[model samples]
Target: MAETNLQVLLRRRPKGAPVPEDFEIVETPVPVPAEGEVLVRHQYLSLDPYMRGRMSEAKSYAKPVALGSVMEGRTAGVVVASKAPGFAPGDSVAGGFGWQRFSCVTPAGLIKVDPQEAPLSANLGVLGMPGLTAWVGLEDIGQPKAGETVVVSAASGAVGQVVGQIAKIRGCKVIGIAGGPEKCRFVEEELGFDACIDHRGDLNAQLDKACPEGIDVYWENVGGPVQAAVFPRLRDFARMVMCGVIAQYNVVEGADSFGGPPGPYLGAVVRKRLRIQGFIVSDHGWPRYPQFRREMLGWMADGRMSWREDVVEGLRNAPEAFIGLLQGRNFGKLVVKID
Candidate 1:
């Protein structure tokens, strides 16, 4: 076992988009497990858009990452030492282990995973939180019906890919909005979205062409001009599943600038009788997780769903990779492979 634990700490809050200097990487002694605690050695760390919100002091659903503390993140790992029952060395697990190579956690904090069922890294992606987020948001909120148009923004991303595929399964005409031609191609040709518009292009015109019938359900992931374009296209009685807004995450201004004022859309909401509900996945809890896992695994087995990961080679590169993710440079779910 390595003697030292490598960690990425929040050095300072970013005024806007996060930079490398905002994080501090340091080596410290690997933590020892106490009674009822297990020491885990992380293999892969998940980087997500929500972490950007955590990096700021602004109020949100969750607390901010304290200064000088390890940056908050989820990881898939193996147990190296255990003082907890039902957990032994070599057992695969997934949990909020932050951006560190090792963590000492209680059994309740970890979910044991089977390598035979899926790749250990997958527990942090498609079959994990991202998958759950997509499932809950689309099923509970979007409530898509067959032949209805379902549009997903950030279509090539971790949650968006799953959202579009599931919408397809539910018999919706799924259109995706992604950045660049390559990502749009992956969303359409690979993931089977009906069509994908490149946000870098004329978003409004392309959306008009793709969603000519007007959007019945809009799964929002990017909330800037993309949201603006989709908002005006929502059909009567349409449902809008409000998820993340990556485009606004880096705004240096106050919270009012986050989603750009909803005032203009208020008249449309009442006129169209639209349903817009923002959600955080953890709010739904683990009760529905078994249902999500069962349906998602079945979809994967039947070849109805697919996923991709943009993996960074080492822990040291996470900050750069994460910055690239926010800039839309990553083509898929971004994860850091710890070495």
Candidate 2:
């Protein structure tokens, strides 16, 4: 076992988009578990868009990362030492281990992951938080019905990919809005979305042509021009599941800068009788987790669901990979493999 632990600390809060200099990497002694705590040696760390929001001082659903502290993240790893009951060394687990190579956590803070069910990295993606977020947003909020037209922005991303696939299985005609042609093609052919619009093109026109019947369920992920394009097309009584607004995440300016103002859409919201609700997946709590895990695993086993990952090797490359994620450069779920 290594004598030291490598950790990424939030050296500086980002002003707009994050830069490499905003983070600092340092080494320290490996943490020793206390009573009822287990020491974890992380193998893979999940990089997500939500982390950007946490890096800022702005008030959000979650607290901001304190400067000079370890950057927050979810990780999948093996237990190296344990003082907790029912947890033993060599067991695979997933928890909020942050941007570090090792962590000490309690049983409540971590859950065992079965490699036989799926790859260990999957615990941080499709079968994990992102996947659960997709399910809850669509099923609970969107309430998509068979033959309904469902549209998801950022469709090739971690959460968006799962949303689209699940919508398809629910018998909805899924249309995806992605960045490039390659991602659009993958959404259409590989993930089996009904149609995909490349946002770089004429978005309004493409969306109109693809969703001729008007959208019944709109999963909001990117919330700038994409939100503008989709909002006007929602059918009467349409359900809009507000997930994340990655397009506006790095906007240093106020919310008004992103898609102009929400004033223009408020009238339509009332006129269309739209059901728009924003949610933080964690609010749903543990009661629904088993259902999510069971259903997702079954989908994987039946070959109805699939996912992709963009992996960056070494903990040191996390900042670079994360920058790419915010820029829409990553092709799929971005993860860092600790070296």
TM-score of each: 0.97, 0.97
Model 2, residue pairs in steric clash = none
Write candidate 2's Cα lDDT for 37-93 as tens digits. Answer: 999999999999999988999888899999999999999999999999999999999
Q: Relative to the unseen true structure, what is the C-alpha lDDT of residue 199 in candidate 1, on a scale of 0 to 100?
A: 91
- Candidate 1 per-residue lDDT, tens place, 1-339, comes to 758999999999998889999999999999999999999999999999999999998888899999999999999999999999999999999999899999899988699988988888888889999999999888789999999999999999999999999999999999999999999999999999999999989988898899888999999998988888889999999999999889988889565464546787998889999999999999984679888888888998899999999989999999999999899989888899998
Candidate 2 residue-wise lDDT at 225: 85
Angstrom error at residue 233, model 1: 0.6
Model 1 earns a TM-score of 0.97
Per-candidate clash tally: 0, 0
